[model samples]
Target: MKYRLFGILAVLFFLAWQTLDGMVEGDWGRLEGGLANLSIFFKESMWPPNWSVLEARSYPVCEQDIEFFCSVGYLGMMETLKIAFVSTILGFIGAICLSSLAARNLMPLYISLPVRIFLSGVRSLPSLIWAILFVIVIGFGPLSGVLAMTFYTVGYLGKLQYEVFEGMPSEPLEAGRAMGLSKPSIVANIVIPENGNHLLSQLMFMFEYNVRHGTVIGIVGAGGIGYYISTYLKFLQYDKVFALLLLIFVVVVIIDLLSLMVRSFVNEEGDVRKPTWLNTLLKAKRSKASLVESE
Candidate 1:
């Protein structure tokens, strides 16, 4: 069995390599000196990132005691976070409604089919295209960004949620039916509670996805840090762009940590022992004792 698995993987890798080679026209030499070129580019254009992006603009009268509070990095990042938060929440609500209808186990085929088709249509357009469309429809701003992200999130998250619902165990649904619970009641009590962990996981993932894409959409004048990034790129201000990218990286890291902490609460809830604050403290103490003993 292991040998068969290895053989399958080897064939898949070979096929992938062949496909890539075909696309590149077998010009592997193009990779030669790539590292050296990147090094030179970084040194000449992006090294020693400009910290001025962290300083408040002169035209903006300094109302705050700290300049960083009014800095481009802070404002842009906060705007992006706000846009992501609002859109994720709106999209999650919309997705839950649609997904409940679309899930095969939750709804009849006639209802699920049309809703699935609609979700597919929505998901067909990339978020970037949605942003552009919204910008054209409503003039540029955060509003356009919000609308674009919300639409994309609904389609993407709806598919994930409905699939999760369909994959749920049949026993609770049957029990709900036996209990004469209506569809809404079943969904609220049985479906949602059973799938709480998965729903929360998808919610966090979609928020993170929207936050990253917020930068991309902002390049189209939808308002975010990407607006400043586009401006810097236009002026060949690679150092400032690099600094902004670093700031984005830091913000994304913080969001990831936040997601991890939030998910930790729900992760051990079912058959495993649920962790409380006191239990967590005790566990930490136990770990410290174990480490000391090993030492």
Candidate 2:
């Protein structure tokens, strides 16, 4: 155990040394000076957020101006949300189909093995690289972002869904077969219902992740809030950049809360209970009463 601990520490120290060496090689001499300037820049640019800027509209000066003159910040935010939503939904559909085929218990090795390999290949690439590839193929737009998110979602959700399906109780599936249910019927009636809550939870979590990723993909000209973020930072408009960052933060928080609520509703203890704090308290009280009565 002591040797194992020492080996782990040695590896960690080596990694840290390598990282520091890389940073120094990349020129750390200016970093200290740059940090002081950065502090001043942040104070001047981000201290007073322009809340009214999101509501301000640009006057139409040209065809392109007319296309995006109304509430630039809000419109960008909406586009980001749309990209995340559409990609997640499309990817989830694709994942469900692929997961059914990929489950080892449901399909033979010949069928499932190839699918597992394909999904692994897909999962190997990061979403940013996928976005860049799509942008190269399709040109700069939300289409690239959507395609990137969709493909990444399929890779991620497929693996998780197949694992869930494989771990599911096989007794119900056998019972369905004995009752003369078809394969599709058995999966639809038995497998899905048993894992519905878990699947939904995973989907919601993926959507939340995609929303955060959507903002990043737009930096590569994929057309969302990230595009504006990149633009503002390039022009040194740190106030606008900070505002966009705050907006993204708020959106993420809201989605996280909604996902939590959905999980609570679907995976409620015992029966299908209301996902409310009061309901939780009520359930606790009832359980305590039942225990007393039994005693």
Candidate 3:
């Protein structure tokens, strides 16, 4: 234990030293100067937030003679949503197909082992790195972002789904086999229905994650909100940047609420219980009503 602790500390110290050396080589003094004026910088950049950017009318309209017209921020946001939505759907489908073969309980060792390894290899790299590679190969655009997100999603959702499949009770499989059901029929009719809610939950979570990733990939010219963010930051337009950030936050919150509602519905019983907090409140209300009736 003593030697292990010493090794860990030594590794940490070496990492810290490397970080400091890189900072020094990259002119750490500039960062220190910026930190010293951080308050001033925030005051100048974020004060009197120009919320007019959020108003649709604030966007410029092209002349009637012009062939096209669009708001940059609005279009960028929509594009980001599109990239996330499309990629997530494609990824979920791919994950579902691969997961059946990947599940150890559902497939032979030779088949499942290779599938698991392939998924692990795909997941080893971050989505940003994948986006960069796709950008180089496919050229900069939403296509690159879509492909990157899809690949990452497959690696991610595949692992989760296969585990879920593998963990399923053996009773159902045994019963299905006794009934002479084929493997494909057993999986489709029995396993899928049993785990429908979990699969949907995973897909929703992945969609939320992909939305955030979509924005980051756009920074590399994948053509989404990140592209607009990069452009605004380059021009030092912090107001617009903040506006876009706010829009993203709002959208993410909406998605979260929607997912919560859907999950609640999927898990609902006779009562409309959902969102644990709300369920508790409803239970309290019912208790109060029962006491009043008894009185």
Candidate 4:
């Protein structure tokens, strides 16, 4: 019976995959003919990069404008970081609250289903579209970026946290209630601690995701490194565009490495060696006054 079920599933998977593949191929056929036009397009606009800006030749094409772009580029990136970090913090908190209510063992279908639908709606809209909406509502610049990042973070974290909640054990939850603990108390003492690492890991993951989203949101005038890169491309400043690409790559790689460290710290809590300073912060803050008062 198991073998038959597996064979049927495998055949269905293959057919479904091919059906989607054929649909994509049909669309690609329409664009494939125009693919060669890119070469012709580039040939018509021969824009050489200002590589000499680093040294001689005195590439004096809009020195003031270049300076402004460089400054604004960094500022825009900083604004993006601000938006991403702030949105992630608020969104992660909101997700936790929603997840507690979304968990099947914890909440009713009427509640969880609506929340799930809401999250789907949030994630369904592309970041660019979100930015456009925000621009209409909040006006342009970093405000739009913040709103877009906020929704994205909510969708991503709520989806992830709900999964964590679903995987949670029932034994402790039942035991807590048997002991007459309130639901909130049970969640705080049992669920939150048990899933702290997972929550933090998701927060970090969302941080990285929103960082990339920040850069892209700026293309819609939401403000980020993309603003500079796009402007440079508009003016045919290939070198500046290339510089933005390199810088974004480095920033993303660094953030990825930081995320890996955070994940390792969370997952390897039992195996990690002791630290002097970094480890001290993780030690639960205990008040001597409380201990003395209790004594």
Candidate 5:
């Protein structure tokens, strides 16, 4: 069994390596100076990131007492965050409505199939394409970003939600059915509560995804930090772009921490014991250790 597994993995690895070599046209020598070139480029053009993006623009005439509030970083990041939040909410609601209709356990095959197809159609187009389409229709702004992300969120989340519904234990659903509960009532009182953890998880994940993609859409004049990043790129201002990139990294990390905190409320751990600030701040391993000790 072990030898068979090793052979399968070896074959997969060989295939992947051969495919990569073919794509590169076997020009393996081209990688010799890659590290040195990257090092030189970074030191010469990207080191010592410019901090001016954190201060109010000269032409903006900063009215706020705190100049940071008027800074490009703050304004742009806030706009991106707003777009992400709005889209995540709208998408979650839309996805729930559709997913309830599409789940095989909840609906007949004929009913579920069409809804599933519709979701697939929505999900087929990447968010970037949706952003471009909306940009053309609305002439570019945060609104365009929101609509694009919202559409994508519906498609992605709908699939996840219906699968969660179908995978749930059959007992509660059967009990609900025996009680002559309406489909809406069963969904509202049973399916959602049972899958609250997963739903919240997907919601948080989509919000983070949208926030990151906001930068991409902004490049096409959709509005956000990406617009400014695009401007800096046009002028070859790598230092400013690097600084903005760092800001985005920090924001994404913060969002991840927030996701952990939010999901803690609905997850199994929450049922075992109420979440505490200490648990939220602790590493997962340490939290598990503490939980074990406490128990």
Candidate 6:
């Protein structure tokens, strides 16, 4: 059976790879042309550095006063990331709550339907639009970007979490209730424990999405790498642009690897089984013996 499964997987993988190769080959000319255009664009854009504006912006970056232009640009990126992180966390928590109530098995159609519609609406609005609108109220910076990302994440994560909740086996929940547990107790003791790993996985996955978006929101003045990118690119500083892009690439890749490790750790659900009564009592006795020994 294992061999059969592996064979099937190999065949499927080959077919998928072949399909992708065909698509890439079909677009080869277009891809090459696009690449050429991009190269030309960068070559043309990268001259005449805006040294004057850069000089005016000459202020201390992070209190060290390294260089004005670079510092401001970096400051903007830091703000962007701060917004993304804060918003992602807030949105994820909100989504967890909404997802719990929104699960079809847990709630009736009337309740779940409305929540789903609201979430859908939230998802419909692009984060960029939210940033633009909030930028008016907040008047720029990472604050607006964070708010936009949070709202969007709440919608997205809420929907996905509900799906996760719905897919969960009811047996454990039923077992908890059969012992006369309350709904909240069942959720706290069983639902959360069972879904803890899944939730962690989802959170790790969303971090990448948030980072990508954190870039976009910067265009409307949300801050982060985007602002610096815009500044250098506008001045035709392709080298600096490449430098910034390299930084983003490295950071994102490193974060992605860390997330993968976390996913692996969580998926294992290390020692998830509840402690047996005897095991707990035995451990307690051991602790008591150690205390007596100390005396």
Name the top TM-score candidate.
Answer: 5
Model 2 agreement with the true structure over 105-211: per-residue lDDT tens digits: 77889999999999999989988989999999999999999999999999999999999999998899789878999866876888888999989998999998998
Ranking by TM-score: 5, 1, 2, 3, 4, 6
- TM per candidate: 0.91, 0.79, 0.77, 0.72, 0.95, 0.71
Better of 4 and 6 by lDDT: 6
In angstroms, give how far residue 245 of model 4 lies from its true place: 1.6
Q: Is candidate 2 or candidate 4 better by lDDT?
A: 2
Off by over 4 Å in 6: 1-33, 42-57, 65-74, 269-295
What ordering of candidates by lDDT runs from best to worst? 5, 1, 2, 3, 6, 4
Candidate 4 lDDT tens digits, 1-295: 9999999999999999889888788565667758577666545543343333223223334445445443544555567778889889988888888778777777779988888888888878887788889988888778788888887778778888888978999999889989999878877899888898899878888888888878788777887766766777789776656655666676777787667566656565435443334333434343343356679
- Candidate 5 deviant stretches above 4 angstroms: 288-295
Please provide, for model 3 over 19-115, each residue's C-alpha lDDT reduced to its tens digit, 9 standing for 90 to 100.
9988689665567767658777767896655565544433355443422225566678889999999999999989988898899887889999999
Instruction: Report the C-alpha lDDT of model 1 over 43-69, residue by residue, as the tens digit.
Output: 999999998999997877879999998
User: lDDT (0-100) at residue 294 of candidate 1?
Assistant: 83
lDDT of all predictions, in order shown? 0.90, 0.84, 0.83, 0.73, 0.92, 0.74
Predicted candidate 3: what Cα RMSD to the true structure?
Answer: 5.9
Clashing residue pairs found in predicted model 3: none
Q: Give the TM-score of candidate 6.
A: 0.71
Instruction: Name the weakest run of 10 consecutive residues (lDDT summed) in model 4.
Output: 51-60
Q: What tens-digit string does per-residue lDDT give for candidate 5 at 73-173?
A: 99999999999899999999999999999999999999999999999999999988999999999988999989998999999999999999999999999
The local lDDT score (0 to 100) that residue 22 gets in candidate 1 is 99
lDDT of 6 by residue, 1-295 (tens): 9999999999999999889889788565566678788877767764333323323244433344455435544555466668778988999988987887788877779988999888989989988888888999888777788888999899889888889888999899778878999866776788878998888877877777888778777777877767777777677677666655655676678667767655555564324423343434464575566578789
**CA-only RMSD, every prediction:** 3.3, 5.3, 5.9, 9.8, 1.7, 9.7
